[model samples]
Target: MAILATGQPNLEAGQSQSLHYDDFPPLNSCSKLKIGTPRLPIVPSLPNERECKIGLLRNRHVLIGLELQEDFINVMAKNIYYLLAKDGYLYTMKPLIYDAKFKVEEETTLTMAWISFPDLKPTFFVKESIFSLATAVGKPIHLDMATINKTRPSCARVKFQVDLLANFPKFMEMETVNEDTKETKIERVKIHYDRLPRYCLHCKVQGHAEEECRSIHPELHQYVARD
Candidate 1:
């Protein structure tokens, strides 16, 4: 008793005719044979009433449906990247022509190299007076005098988180007391930032030198050399 299979043929030499289904080995006979689930493409299901309609306008613009609070919109506009809100409208910062062009503002945190001309004592920058002046440029988050190299004790630096609106003046005025006259005199000291070499003292690595290995606290805040 034999039956010809639709597509499978005999594998023996000189035999080109279709073989019977029974002539083939049974699935149970092959110990290595394994059945697998068929691969199917994933498709997203349609949204229901719980899902608000959200779409893009003009390919790039976003159209958010549902009533939104003013405070929520403002916070979203400010916190989000490359987005701005004006007159109760949320807009993206791409395609410059979409709105009035302006410098996209952001907060920058960094540890900057601070060296006072004549190299005032490391305590000079930490003084309340000097700190106030420093804040005039940026918010002084931390002062790391301990990181100052023993060889370069006068070249200590501080980490500051600055607002974009702050002013980083090239020179700062330092009020000094004259010895003989006992009079107050103002002297200007030139300011330099991020002039130190980037070398990791802990790991002996180049590019990033820190009090501790940056590999451990990779998320620690860093500053831009130019900005």
Candidate 2:
């Protein structure tokens, strides 16, 4: 069974997502992740006052429901994949849309990538400082071990969870001190991504580029030219 849409397709964070429901299978069933159990413990019913509802699908997955039509959600859906657990098992959930006007099938632009700061001021390599600067772009996950230890002095690398839908600044303005004179200065520091997956600006999906997007350029599909 597939989730289909018509007219306009939409998947948003503040929305409920239905899933294929199945009683937990043995860990061997999922050797890749080595997770889940066979025990199908009773799930207590949700409180009448509280929102967030749940339902089973094809007895394969469990999906949540809410009051709003878009399946209202107050917290991020990804977090639920890690945070919300029953009997020490995290709830399996489909990735939700990070931005409006897309579907989970295409995936949200949110991604984890290593961003490098070329010739970054060494003094700012500290966690607090790195995080402070990184926040200007996105959520900082961790600093490269070499960066944390200041072993690799060429550049500082930090893994961040960034939204690909937004523009990435080539330079980040940072305050630093000059050797010639003990004065504060805001310098434009170069920011580089060690590597990045393709992202389509036209379709607003991460994986392929805009020019390579078939949806934006349907002619790319035409093999025979018409007169």
Please report the candidate that would top lDDT against the real structure. Answer: 2
Model 1 pairs whose backbones collide:
199-209, 200-209
Please write out the lDDT profile of model 1 over residues 1-227, one tens digit for every residue.
11112322111111122222222111110000012211222111112233333333332333333332222222222212222223333333221101122222311122233433234444443334334444545544334445333344555455443433233556655555545566765445555554433545455432354655557677775967994
lDDT of each model, Cα atoms only?
Answer: 0.34, 0.51
TM-score of each: 0.30, 0.50
Model 2 TM-score, all chains together: 0.50
Model 2 has an lDDT value of 0.51
Ten contiguous residues minimizing lDDT sum, candidate 1: 24-33
